[model samples]
Target: MTTAPKVALVTGATQGLGLALVEGLARRLAPDDTVYLTGRDAGRVAEAVRAVPGGGARVRGELLDVADPEAAALLAGRLEERHGGVDIVFNNAVMRVGPDDDPREIIDGYAEVNNFGTTRVLRAFGPLLRDGGRLIVVASSLGTLHHLAPVLHDRFDGLASLDEVDEQTAAWRDAVKDGTARSGAWPGFVNIPSKIAQVAAVRALAERRRERDAARGVLLAAVCPGMLNTPTSALWWDVGDAATPAQGAVPLLDLALGPVDPDHYGQLVRHGKVVPWRP
Candidate 1:
């Protein structure tokens, strides 16, 4: 009997790192395999699927906003019914902070999609993950504990549950709004905490689902794709010579399809290796 084809899905894949992931998957997966790329905009999703390498014959696009639990659930049901289950899931959806954006606004609103949205996707599609499947979250090196003060390290390291991470995130956001964030030694950059929460969620989920994931041979991980010359990066810094999205997708693709190393699960990875959360 012929081996079954793998089914992979990517969120927020209309452009940037997410888009790069679809392109890379198109190249790596067998021609018979299917790759699903989703974004909130149907037109962009269609356009992105059309532009994939090899004319995107094996790729499909869907309208999915990670923040919309209903849409996520519907898509999960559809994938389960049509493909049996998904073999790889790349959670790449993120609402980036703009140069002039309000700090409090980034925390309150963006977190809905950036931090919590990821958790939404996980809960929705996690059960449908096939045996030996991989779930990868595209986080950032800026989210690492090394960027935060030593006083805050223990708190983040000790986060054992999703609720704990959420509570900590809420407190951080409140601090920023009240001008006590700096006094509390939180990083000045708003994106840092958001990314930190994103990464922490991965660890918390991995710990909570350790037995289930182990029995099903599922792998969960978060990764920093590195600085890339994308519109999101352009919002904060000069693009000059920064790695392109295609280049940045390398590490992400590795985590998505590389050999399973339990040690790397729940860790933030970059350049094909686990990045230490602290010095």
Candidate 2:
């Protein structure tokens, strides 16, 4: 008997790791399977689809801004109507700011796009994930709980729901804006809190929807692709001999399409291994 066609969705696929994910999926999936690559810019989305390895009719492009819930919902609806449901979903959209940028703006920007935006995408696309599907959130290594103070560890480690995660992230942002972040024992770096929130969201979501996910065998994981030689990495640190975007995408591709490990769900994984959340 012939296997059914699979459907995949990858956010922020116009460039870098996201782009590589689209390419990897395109090459790995059967030709009849559909791989949807999304980006905010229509032009870039079209270009990325065209640039995928062995580009074919199976590769499709769509315009999506993860920060926009309406757009995500609409896209999910289209996928449901067209393909019945999605087999794989990769949340790869992100935003970063330089040190010189305003702390409040940086915090809010990251929170909106990287933290809450991740949750929004999950909420919209999660229900559409077919049985035995995978949902991978592209987080950063800096998003670990150990990066924060011990006092803050339980707050994140104990996240049981998305609402709680939101409250924690909001509290961190408020502390920063009110000049109490340092005293509150939260990390001073603007990106750390948001990244922490992103990972925490994944953990919380898994906990909140454990029963439903278990029945469907849907896997949820937060992944750190590690530092890559992308433009975003170059702007923040010296990436001498860093893994290329394609190389960094290896683990991500594996997680997206490889064997499902029940232990990996709701945890942060790197290089095909689970990374400790706490120090």
Displacement of the residue 189 alpha carbon in candidate 1, Å: 0.8
TM-score for each model: 0.91, 0.93
Best by lDDT: 1
Tens-place lDDT digits, model 2, residues 159-278: 788888888887887777777886667777778878888888898888877778877788999999988997667877899889998898888888878778888988899888888887
Please give the TM-score that candidate 1 achieves against the real structure: 0.91
Instruction: Give the Cα lDDT of each candidate.
Output: 0.84, 0.84
240, model 2: CA deviation in Å? Answer: 1.5
Q: Cα deviation in Å at residue 111, candidate 1?
A: 0.5
TM-score of 2: 0.93
Which 10 residues in a row give candidate 1 its minimum summed lDDT? 102-111
Q: Show model 1 residue runs off by greater than 4 Å.
A: 55-57
Q: Compared with the true structure, what per-residue lDDT tens digits does model 1 show for residues 1-279?
A: 887789999999999988999999989989889999999998899899888879432999988987775878899999999989999999999888887877865666777788778878878787888888998888888878888888887766758887788788778878888879867788878888888888888888888888888777788989888889987788788888899999999877877887778778788888878888777
Q: Which pairs clash in model 2?
A: none
